[model samples]
Target: MNVFEVTLQPASLKNIVIIGCSGAIGKALVEALISRFPDASIYGFSRTASFHSLEKKPDKYQEARIDYEDEASIAKCAALAAETGPLDLVIVATGILHQGEITPEKSLRDLSAEKMMALYQANCITPSLLAKHFIPELNKGSTSVFAALSARVGSISDNALGGWYAYRASKSALNMVIKNAGIETARRNKSAIIVGLHPGTVDSDLSKPFQANVPAGKLFRPLDSANYLLQTLLQLTPNQTGKCFAWDGQEIAP
Candidate 1:
């Protein structure tokens, strides 16, 4: 079902944080949120020192520098965001499909410890760390969401065409982290919902190289993907917290 077609009730979102805000989907999400919640405060973090668009609107947006490799930076940024008020949402949009000379391995023979580690660090560790620090800041009395961008390839039950070993493994690990965190968050705050999201093939740097094989309707603009994701989040309840959901709001098997 396309969640975007559902009518959206006004969400009580006063503050939000989008980690890895410099990425294509992240930027789109920020813009979408700004348009929808003009009064809400949005915090963004990227590896770079600042985001020009967010910087232009200091009243509604705040930008911070974060290096996923450095836990201290992540902690500091989270602390700064938490000080603003209770966060209604936290989305970890940071992930790496390739870095430097390392591309996804097509076979077991192509896999290397270094390449696997890099994928694990970017796709798993970063989001896990973001959850570790930010999940606690969510409002306990209201419906709050914590989401990470996970790929459908991460779904073991759904993996028919196998390849992209490192990327797949790392994302699978991320799904596990989201599930485990969701359980703990539910225990602490019954209103908190944590889940992984599959954004499909968005037109971005991450999907640009592989877009040739994507079905026509499956290749989505970043803004459209972002809007769909936000709509899906609005439909989530605590009972559906631990699953990985697609852009259309259908659950992806883990």
Candidate 2:
């Protein structure tokens, strides 16, 4: 299916959460979710609770702070969200590609153990922890999704022109986490879907430095990427869980 199309939602989506709402894609997703599900409660979170900066906020929206590296902060937020109602969707929109002194290594000689750990913490551990706390909060009676941003480079089988050791490896670990969570969640609720999303090199700080290499029509705006990601979620079923898909709804082979 073309994820860009506004496909009719098959599941009754009610409550949603977007982690890393301070980021470009995360903030756009919050706005998309509000527009797509006007009656649904949106719990947007970031280290800064940046949703307040949005010009047009929704009445059902809730903004809060979240330290992505802290398990306590994630657990607390999950508990608070659960208290309101069952979760319909949880989007872990956080990732680290280039920030501060961290950049994708061009060769093995440039690899640092500390940088690898930092990448793993942001890309894999944080999202996996989010799943650990929030998966149970998902509505068990109906179809729901627990999705996090992954990348095309994460696929071990798809790796070509490999250079980014830490970022690629960390995202690969995240894909495993998604697969593991999907299996466990299936046992708990057969209707639940767990998967990874590849937003396809969005026009954001994360991809800005690397955009010079991107081909025409491949790079996307944050809002466009958000809608495409959401559209992929709305179309996916239980049988398709535990897999990774691109923004255009094309499955990324593991």
Candidate 3:
């Protein structure tokens, strides 16, 4: 069949719902989605009350409160978003590196159960909860993509220099959750693509401290990373589900 003959079904189109919409990448994604798919609805979910202030918010776009730690809240948000229409895309951009209470440990001695568990709750358990609750929102007409922002350091095979053990372990757990979701979703929604994406070091509060150590051409602004990641996500086929990929389109080793 010729390219014109190829059918891109409604399920293949992206009507996106973004979690953690108040974050740097989340804000950029809202703008990028609007610019790229002018007609697509972009629903944003965050715990904060300021989600409506995003640039060029679509008429169809709406915002709601979501607490990732609460499974019931996630289900409710998903149900509400699905009620609006069939969702073609779901992106989870929520993550934390170093917060006031949970700082990244530089040494083994600094590691504590409390800090590690907190990181895991924020990075892994929450995303898993999102996957568990939000799967119903995806359109089954064509290929739909569900993606979560993961970290490269989460790759167990790629670890050469290691320090942030808790952060790394938490993200690694998230990677597994995404992979497992992909497998299960494949059996049910054969056309859906569930993936884990590493967005690299972008200009955000999460990466602010690490920016000083990044090399000349490596760092990216939140908008740039979001744009690149969107393009990558759009290009994903059903066959690529359950895979982890870097921002540059490189497959990350598990």
TM-score per model over all chains: 0.94, 0.94, 0.93
Q: What's the alpha carbon RMSD for model 3?
A: 2.7
In the predicted model 3, the residue pairs found to clash are 11-142
Give candidate 3's whole-model lDDT.
0.83
Better of 1 and 3 by lDDT: 1
Please report, in order, the local distance difference test score of every candidate based on alpha carbons.
Answer: 0.87, 0.88, 0.83
The candidate that wins on TM-score is: 2
Give the C-alpha miss distance for residue 209 in model 2, angstroms. 0.7
TM for candidate 1 is 0.94
How far off is residue 104 in model 3, in Å?
Answer: 1.5
Model 2: which residue pairs collide?
A: none
Give the per-residue lDDT digits (tens) of candidate 1, residues 1-254: 33213222346788889988899999999988888888889998999765646545648787878878888888888889989788888999999998788898888999999999999999998899989989999877577889999999999999999999999999999999999998988888778888999998999988888889999799999999999999998888778887899999999998
**Model 3: per-residue Cα lDDT over 1-254, one tens digit each:** 33212333433455778999899999888777777777777789998877646545568778889977778899999988788677788999998899888788889998999999889988998888888878767877676778899999999999999899999999999989888888898788777788899998998899998899999978998889998888778666777788888887787899
Model 3 segments beyond 4 Å from truth? 1-14
lDDT of 1 at 10: 46
